[model samples]
Target: MGDASRPRFMGAALAGEAGSSRPSLESGHHSYPSFDNNSSVYALNPEHGGTESRTGSQYFNYRDDPNDVPMQPLGDSRYLDEKRATYAAPRQRSRAKMILAGVAAGVIALIIIVVVAVYFGVVKKNDNDKSTNNDSASKPSGTSGSGGKGSSSNLVVTGGDGSKVTTDNGTTFTYQNSFGGYWYWDPNDPFNNGAKAQSWTPALNETFNWGVDKIYGVNLGGWLVTEPFIVPSLYEKYPKAVDEWTLSEAMAADTANGGLSQLEDHYKTFITEEDFAQIAGAGLNFVRIPLPYWAIETRGDEPYLAKVCWTYFLKAIRWARKYGIRINLDLHSLPGSQNEWNHSGRMNDVNFLNGPMGIANAQRSLDYIRIIAEFISQDQYKDVVVMFGITNEPEEAIFGLDNLQRYYLQAYNNVRLASGIGEGKGPMISYHDAFLPLTQWAGFMSGADRIMLDDHPYICFGGQSAAPISSYATTPCKTWGANMNTSMSAFGMTAAGEFSNAVTDCGKWLNGVGLGARYDGTFAGSTAVGDCDTWTNWPAWDDTMKSGIKQFALASMDALQNWFFWTWKIGNSTETGKVESPAWSYQLGLQNGWMPTDPRQAAGVCGNTAPWDPPLAPSATGGSGAGQIPASVSNSLHWPPTTISNVGGGATDLPTYTPTGAVPTLSAETFSSASGTGTINAGNGWANSKDTAGAMVAIATCSYLDPWVGQGIAPPSPLCSGGARRRDVPLPLITPPPSPS
Candidate 1:
């Protein structure tokens, strides 16, 4: 029997030889033909000069010997004996030769089959790469008026038209750009700023004239920066966990479920390239990304995952760049909570510019701001990241307005130093309203570079009322529109950073985890307005409900001419398995037919209410007077204010960090193309290497208080105080300019 381990073809060939005729050996001299002759062994017919046309059946015809010699009858005993004697020896040799030939033929056949498969596989791969390149070439880099060089021809389009692209870490996602937008990357020149976000928006290479170009934007909330209302599952897992700070602690103790590393999974999965593409397809141009300070680095036993989100942040930038979406990078949470809110990393203490450790926290915040400014100012990112929100919703009531302004001035100056003093040199510095009136900041910084005031106007959180949704449709038009229009002319460039559709606080965990909503009277001291089921149940919403929400959304769009919707998406509750706060999500609104298909349709929603037309100031449009600040104004708003509100004595009495000369600079994140041999290497995150100042570090001799929990405590000793500039120099109070008559 043939060896079972041998090739199947060899076994089959050997089996065919079983009953075949055998060559006979004549007396004394062996007459068996030699198998070594190639023509005699393999030729179909040696009679016709080793070439003959044979039928299918004739091809398998076999003869024991090449000569076609006949076998003698077995009746002759002498002849039979002679035949048996010679046949035994010659037959054994012939059988061995046939086995070797069959094995050789089987090997050659396998080689041919393997060669064919490999050749076709390589050809198919090349064809796919070529097709991808062709698809990329079909996309337009910019609009007709955009006078910029288009993207490089060699760039292979890995994404566009909902095509799938795998990231370097093997994370696969569909790039959902149905709009006439494309991702532009030229490896030869990484800083080529010539890609458009959409056909309606200006190309990255062109100037974005604020007020002239409408910002149809959406906020990427609850991503990078964790929020209980947005992602309930993360908080619901641990019953005791209230916010990210507590969540991190709880998750750390439970190592069975990946421990603190689970956050990295959330970072990877929560929002992806597809989301950015969807935003673009929805006719949105700008994305406001709320990032936490821990994304840069964590300090002093902080339980947060440090620098992990930075990888995703970089990915966000690339995805935004690909989809032609501009970014307004907002520093959502600071070292200590910016506001004593859960979204600010911690829930209770307003240590940032508020308590005993306020000054120290602000110092660390400034260093981070400077570090970020240096990174974004680089040519690689300046075009994409146009606005930098220095802070997100600081409680001005708790942290005095004067202290906040001083900090803002310091941050502004540091950013200017890191970047240069000129238009387009860096991002426009954005400051939140700090929950204060926009009018209060009318002329706060009259002539101090390119600055913008951001306000978050939301009717949902302003106590509950059982009013019909249609009744509130015109509220935004009458109130928000007028306020924003007035502020634009008064404050140069003002934008509603966040606004949502929900007229009442109704969603699960909308207030916070375990903290119920005011709509159903679950919140403390809040009166019940109506049943929350109607608001939270999106599937049950009727046409009338959708119409009211749509009108309200349109009015809001018109009101906040330059605005970013509160959030682009809202995650579903693990318990419910559906989006509880459907009204707040711009994505859900679009999917449900509540949001306008084209945002421009909202332009004249409020009849006769024209949008604010900005004045022709060089500084406003990043022109000649872009970063020019009046000397008087510059001198008045000095860093390290004369005194902090809660801290005793002067600013010198506040706890602070000493510069350790160890700046943690953010490096670039890179990606390889899925279809071709191309790579996008975002340059080292630092824009200006010369502006390197030592990072802030706690002094060893000083006893520092906990920034998060130790609010309202006495300031540390004098040894703990430093990093303040000219403590003896007392600056004049900042008097706000009168509102427009």
Candidate 2:
């Protein structure tokens, strides 16, 4: 909508050299020679011995004396003999002196020639050596310049400490840290934007050892994926717009007000490079970006803008690289709503896994996952986007565990197939606990690839209580700490994906549009305890309240150990002119003295709680057992399970899309500086080109009920049903290559 004709850079296979590896010093005690600056030997220009000068006048000066004797007169007769003797002596002396002078001149000429010859010989040898090195360094690796796994040889170190690197374009940026951290980017490679989330985090080129490195993170919520509570101004403009779906519809209807095209302005302005810089400045290392599936591509009937958000998503990645932050790319919404929440693009029905089109919806989801995996699994991106959250919060209660796990297994298999199975091969597949207890998923897919368990623990949604805010300071530690520790040992790597300082859900639109907060009982089925003014009006909050909130935040950080606070910020509501959800905003808290300036301050807040210290399993760290899910387990959770609860007949009876060969890959926005722009190959959006599976498309002769709202509808025909054939079974287990020594 906004200058669609603008040159949007797409990835291509280009030639580029791999980056040079840093030189490592051997470990040992060593001593260096000390120099004295005042010593003459070290002086830039030292005094040399003076050379003696010889003149013909000094060798033969005879008659210049004033006091000459007169005896020369008596030598008329004897003088003839004296004169002959004198002349003979002078001639012999002159001849000997001339011989000595000629010999000295010849010796000096010989010395000069030998010195010049030796100096040039050494210089030529050194030049030859340098030429050889440059030739090897400049040779391009057989990989795409963008998003390829290869490093760029064109990288030249421009900083004293080797932190600054400049590519062929002359664009220079710093990477590597005092800790063993570094960034890996070849402007030629989009998948390899060299970034290290923190000084302690690994660069895109390095392996990320989960459970070993902690995650001090915040979620970039309501940015790419819009939320009513997070960005209320957008909704306030259209009173009838309750969620993104309706908001899009309302905006589309009003052509005079810039219409739906106005969304491009929001995407560009909502979050900028400054926000990413501030996040890093606040000492946060990782960010969880919740993205909608529409960012990739949308169908003809869908009202949401298609592929516009993808441009912004690419911008987000580049920004993260600039600020040294890692990304957790979360797929928040799917074809049908994964959860019946407004954040999932709609708020009406749980059609993703609990409706007549559930199987069909899931099939679309798998295809999307596969597409994304192929893109991220590219060598360039694997380092920065370390983790991939396949889904946000699916309502497991509505869709049985078996139905959900089947989808999870298929999604995992698809991702592994695209990216391969290993720690650095692709992003760690993250799964949300679906609001279920952690114990319920303790040993899920025990031997499968790198899987991380994500849980969102919040006390705010439990309704208001008479308890004071100060009393909840230690609540997180008491409740979630031990459980998370156990989950790590029992389930594998576990993280509290979302948590906040709010003890009461009192923010505007926190529940939903027009639905008031539960704190004042405006929400259905809740009793009022106190007025909303106290919680919503953050400006009036006293020091005591701020202290309590700070303590609560610290406790949550300590409890979760590895977590991303619900959000980095809460946008100002157009109607309220302030952030109603103050507690949820990490940026707001930090500015007002509620959130910690440095997240590390939360380390010991829980008091002597021995943190989870168990050694990670081989598979957990992308070692030997990676992607080794047992055949029995994989078969049990096969794609398109034989039956589903909501479908009137077998799951195969559900309508599904055919796999056409049309795939949409994400492209990046290129920047031009005084130096030339660096090119990044975004790739073909397919990770495994060997995988020639077609794109998921609507069947030509079939009709589908509204995928979002169609529930309990019987299949119109058997041909409408579609699913994986026996040939679509899970691929064989692949053992990843050993880690570098």
For lDDT, the strongest prediction is 1
Cand. 2 TM to true fold = 0.73
TM-score of each: 0.74, 0.73
Query: Per-residue lDDT for 570-675 in model 2, tens only?
Result: 9998766899889899999989999988676777776633567757787787788688888888888877767765667676566666665366655545432212
Error of 1 at 468 (Å): 2.0
Cα-based lDDT at residue 597, candidate 2? 84
The C-alpha lDDT values of all candidates are: 0.66, 0.65
How many clashes show up per model?
3, 22
Pairs clashing within candidate 1? 197-324, 374-687, 661-694
Worst 10 residues of 1 by lDDT: 6-15
Model 1 TM-score (2 dp): 0.74
Leading candidate by TM-score: 1
